[model samples]
Target: MTALDSFAPAWQIAEAVKSGTVRAEDVTRDALDRIKSLNPKVNAFTDVTAERALTEARRVDAERDAGKKLGPLAGAPIAAKNLFDIAGVTTRAGSKINRDLPAAAEDAELLKRLHAAGAVLLGALNMGEYAYDFTGENAHDGACRNPHDTTRMAGGSSSGSGSAVAAGLAPLTLGSDTNGSIRVPSSFCGVFGLKPTYGRLTRHGTFPFCDSLDHLGPLARSVRDLALSYDVMQGPDPRDHACADRPADPTFETLTDGVAGIKIARLGGFFSTDGMPEAASAVQSVAKALDTTGTVEVEGVEAGRAAAFIITNCESARLHLPNLKTRPDDFDPDTRDRFLAGALLPASWYIRALQVRHWYRENFAKLFQDVDVLLAPATPFPAPLIGQRTIEIRGEEILTRPNIGLFTQPISAIGLPVCTVPVFNSGMPIAVQVISAPWREDLCLRVAAHLESEGIVAAQPPSHL
Candidate 1:
């Protein structure tokens, strides 16, 4: 089958399916066929749920024929990072060790919600093992290459999530952000991604990475799709202790509320683009488009990033201690080495990290009181060449893996909502983070939508693809 206009936005696809202008099954088949054809080039999908997707699509058609009302995301194809449980599929979590685990008995809570909202499950996407990576190179599954330039990284641990959407295999995908997984991939692959406020989304059926810092969200081609996915997959879940017992506050309905009067500020100080010309240009372009000149210094941002690192290392190390003890050789060498180091860290470091988290959250709370939204670079630079270990910043060479999250970690550490908007300024695309106060994801998306409206940012199809 010829591919569905893979470049078409999710909202358009859903509207067509809902109006009977197209059949859901055909859309599913087109997506599956596209995955079969393009996935080898991109290496995005680890598993393709052809049979399951067709079945779901047919059900959607049947419901339409029966005059049953469909949900907001009617007939759009969606996939998740392999970490999310998908019923019979093994929750790989991008690790060789997880391949031996039994298949999940039920779909993840978010997936279930998507299913209810008429999203067909396309399959699972690749990621950095155990969600510990910034680059998309997975030792077990090979790298998920950037769609724009196959030679570059796709950004990860949500690597495949970003690649699939950019490559047009799927319109929307679910990914978890422990540090900058969603935002990094969004920046690198030139797509829109949201790392909703931590705990705003449930982690019940997804694999645990950094228990305290982990957050689940969607990456899409359009800001509205992000709002649609966010609206549906919310609400408290008993299975996840961190899931907030809050009402489902819908953002899609209120999305068109423009950012005219909203106070916006560019984050300065630690977020300055001292070494990354591409990142700096992207931010400046966005500031020009938004017509904002005001800048504010965020105190303790560097320290907050440090706390995020310590907390992530300790929590992930403890979670995988049993496997690290037994199947260390089976694990990816890079991930194993970090896990081992985390295992040896003193307990006091983790405690101090938690204390820092509280302090940082308080600091951001005060900052938000002055501005409704904050702007900053999502990643230090664009996608680096795959297998490139070090990047030059400020005339100093630093490891690429850890430093990619330099701008993102501090905001994520405080569990604030963020939407990374892709800005195409040079050969490769970079992005700017639109951050809002806790529980104010609506503000993040609103600012992102405004930028998109002004033609400053977009998820344009890659020329190479």
Candidate 2:
């Protein structure tokens, strides 16, 4: 678990630094070297702040001798999705339009929290343009290849975060999910990703994709590390209006207590049958592995998704009204047309979506009283071919781009907490979503940790490394 130990977890890395067996400088150097050697093939990182990262690492090591009480994540190297603001780095947000903007004057609020924990900021990761798309293809930075298979996409907006962490470029990463950006990539890349409750983590200085739907969370090699990072990142930031003011529970506690006695079920209906055999079967496999007895169908899921669409489009259009008016050409082709479509949505549709949200949330709450966790597919299919627009599932060619969120959108619309547990089959990875009640991030991670411990969900490294 020293800085020299590749197999050790992040907590071990920090403890090793504290114990002097692994210096912060050495660990940071290893991360930088790994980035230099592996990033080209992965295309995960948009920027690698080698000099700044090493400089910070050296400071952390020096502070140890001064007897400063280091934070829990101290010496852990974290590369954030480009959506997070890095001082001296322009928040390009995976867009060509923002390329000319100057670097931020200070670290973003989330960055500050991570830094306070002794975590090192390595650089900015590539993402879907303005985080509006899935399927990890970046017109500007190039596609982020799936670590498990080079030919497949890594799942996106948070695509680079998934690719980077799965490839071990960094042990921890920050990713945003409006629909399935964080969950999809985490599923495809076989990493633990937590899409915290809607307002559990602050979005301050994190580029806004859809004001009502956008959420930021962590991606890590292990469930514990995900909890560790979330521990530091979850809390209110005055700057973010959506940030909740409640205190945060120790994420580690929830994961360690285990998943026994929890009313767990497989969410059927649109969540399961919509295609994603590998992903759906993965859920059943995990449930059997965990001895889950509850199995239920989620009615009105498709309707919930329609409602989510209204909110996402209406909010996204409002957020980008200026750009859609002036520099529409600068957007990624996928999102450009989508934004234009959103710009034309009727105001009444948006209002109805709001009403739907209130109703859906209440209905979802009743389900939670019967079941603690609802297992669903993170992405209906595994990582697709880089440019694929359609996927054949059960004799039907489904729209690949938007279908990625088939199971995820409805759950997100209700602002629930969920975790993606990666399932591998025939050299490919698919993940199941572990959905919990709102603000119940603890329960989601707990179930995911149970699956991980049983070896149902394993984080396998890329071959040929």
Candidate 3:
């Protein structure tokens, strides 16, 4: 196999393995070797399940040899955020406090689905503490550095998901987005990430952040990989009350349907403000490539963002209240203070936030009447320096962490499906969010695939990879 094959998209790798052009064992070992060599530099993985991966790969090879049909993602190497429950590993969720919990008795529902589909699990990856971060800097596991430039952040709380995929250590990884975790990291690290509508995927055996707005999705080098993984993981789970009971909405079959007649519009107003030139350029590039000249304004976006923050703070704070009341020192200072403050918020404020969320969701849903997809910047900028505390956006200095999700929070607050397409500029990568109405991940993926095919957006391996 050529060196380039190691960095190929997961779908390509799977086809090779299924056709017997490459042994699943060899592919898994090569991926594990890459992780060993490159992970130290990016600090993407907190744990490496090399033995388990090789064992799974061997099973795939044996299955093929026995003339049994393999799954669509057969033999693909993938990983998950540390928040996922691996059978025998502690689900750290990027926190020191959770290290003492007993290992999960069974794998997370998504992991089990991937395994059944023939994907090998490389291991659990590093993440922001308790999913409350956007900078991808974890106090316990060290920051997940961007593969494109190790000096910059990978974007968090799905930091390792972005880094691993961009660095080619693994072709696919799963991440959870509470506000903008998946999209921010994908933008900063240069990869395709999908945040499906809230509750579209099962959350059983995964750590929680904000129950109301939390979502689980895939991050990969290609939109096809995202679609494949998403297709394999979709199903109704009684264990997760929030999981939708609707029929599976398979996206891979329709991913290449082109956006020819799809009505696409750029998000104006708040989305166009407080962002760097690169951010706007990324969105404009996608708009121009798709021949979309229409711009739509969703009013009350700022208020929606505010409501999202209030809801996230209150929900996350409540979830961690027991630990905050005891063993507070174990929590990361950045996370601890936020939780403490949230714990003190008035109940009436949370109620008001919920009301605002409903109002905003209603208004945002109405825009789909004339638009199939909405384009917006994924992050305010590509990525700040690893430890940089402040960023200048349009001449206004702002704290880097919370403001990084400026454009993303408003949309995710309403639980819309969004696909982030990486648009490269001067060797660095920023991304544009192709968003659609609730449960329309196919629309988002369709738009992203068209941009990718047109060469307007794509994932490029970092120099070292």
Candidate 4:
């Protein structure tokens, strides 16, 4: 059997498998081989389900042989961040303490959906401990290195999801974004990532981080793959109370709907890319490509970001309070310290933060009334060197971990849909955030697809890898 190119996008592989040009089992073996060889360099995966992957691939082949139609993601190999449950594999959530727990009884709802679409599960990918950090450094699982530059960070807490797709170990990967986990890594690792409106996708069977702000989405090398994976996973799940009970508004078919009628604008104020040269250039490139000259601002972002921080810290801290009391030493020191701070915050502060969140969301709604889509830098800067704690932005040194989400947090706080498109203006890839109103994921993805069509942005294959 001829092996498929490891770097092929998920859509192409699916087409080849469905057309009988290649066997799904052969593609699965090739994918497993790539993971075995490349995962060590990037530290992207925590587990590799070879037996299960082969079994799934075989099923796909059997269905094809029986003349049964396969789903859109047929024969594609993919992985999920470790925070999502995988049957017989412990959902480590990048924490040593979680290792004490038994393996999950079944896969996460999203994972099951992907499987039903004929995407094979390669395994669980690495991530920041308990999905708390933004730097992608995990004391327990080691750092998920950037595929573009092994010495640099991959961004987190969906570090492995980004790295795996960039390295071509998997064509598609699932990642959860609470603050900026999905967008940050997508920017640093040079891939297309979607953070659907909060509650757009079901989060059942996945470990919780910040319940109010957490979102699950897909990271892929191509916009169509992102759309296809996202389309299949859309629905209502009663198990995840946060999931919206609306009918699925699929974006795959509408991707070619250009930005002609959309009211696109560049973001100013807090979304400005003043300090970071790479980010500034990336945003400028995307704006110019879209012919967008209008600059708009969503007020109250500073307060919104602050509120998101407080909510994330408090909710996550509450979830792990029992573990912190019993096995504090098992927690990552960085994550533990943040959780400790959250534990000490007054209940009144949490209440106030909630109030601020409600106010900020309304502000976003009002801003979106004038614009169909907005553009901003995905990360303040590109990937930092691994273990680098502080970054100098505009002559002032700031903590790298927290500031990475400077632009992403405010949008996440409101649960608006966003699609991050990679722009290669520097050695390390930066990205532009194509944001739309809540439940308007189609608008954001359509804009991203337009950028891709114009060749203004792309997921460039990592040459260093």
Q: Number of clashing residue pairs in every model? A: 0, 1, 0, 0
Model 2 Cα RMSD, 1 decimal: 1.6
> For this target, which candidate reaches the highest lDDT against the unseen true structure?
4
CA RMSD for every model? 1.1, 1.6, 1.1, 0.9
Worst 10 residues of 1 by lDDT: 1-10
Tens digits of per-residue lDDT for model 3, 1-465: 433366789898889888988888899999998899999999999999989999999999999999999999999999999999998899999999999999989999999999999999999999999999999999999999999999999999999999999999999999999999999999999999999998899999999998998999999999999999999999899888889585688999998788878889999988884447888788778888988899889878988999999999999999999999989999999999999989999999999999999998888888999898999999988889989999998898889998999888998898999999998875679999999988899999999998888888999988764
Give, for candidate 4, the lowest lDDT window spanning 10 residues.
1-10
lDDT (Cα atoms) of all candidates against the true structure: 0.91, 0.84, 0.92, 0.93
In Å, residue 45's CA in model 2 sits off its true spot by 0.6
Name the regions of candidate 2 deviating beyond 4 angstroms. 1-7, 273-275
TM-score of 3: 0.98
Model 3 misplacement above 4 A: 1-4, 273-275
* Pairwise TM-score winner, candidates 2 and 4: 4
Instruction: State the lDDT of candidate 4 residue by residue for 296-374, as single tens digits.
Output: 9877999999999899889989999998999999999889999999998999999999999999999889877889999
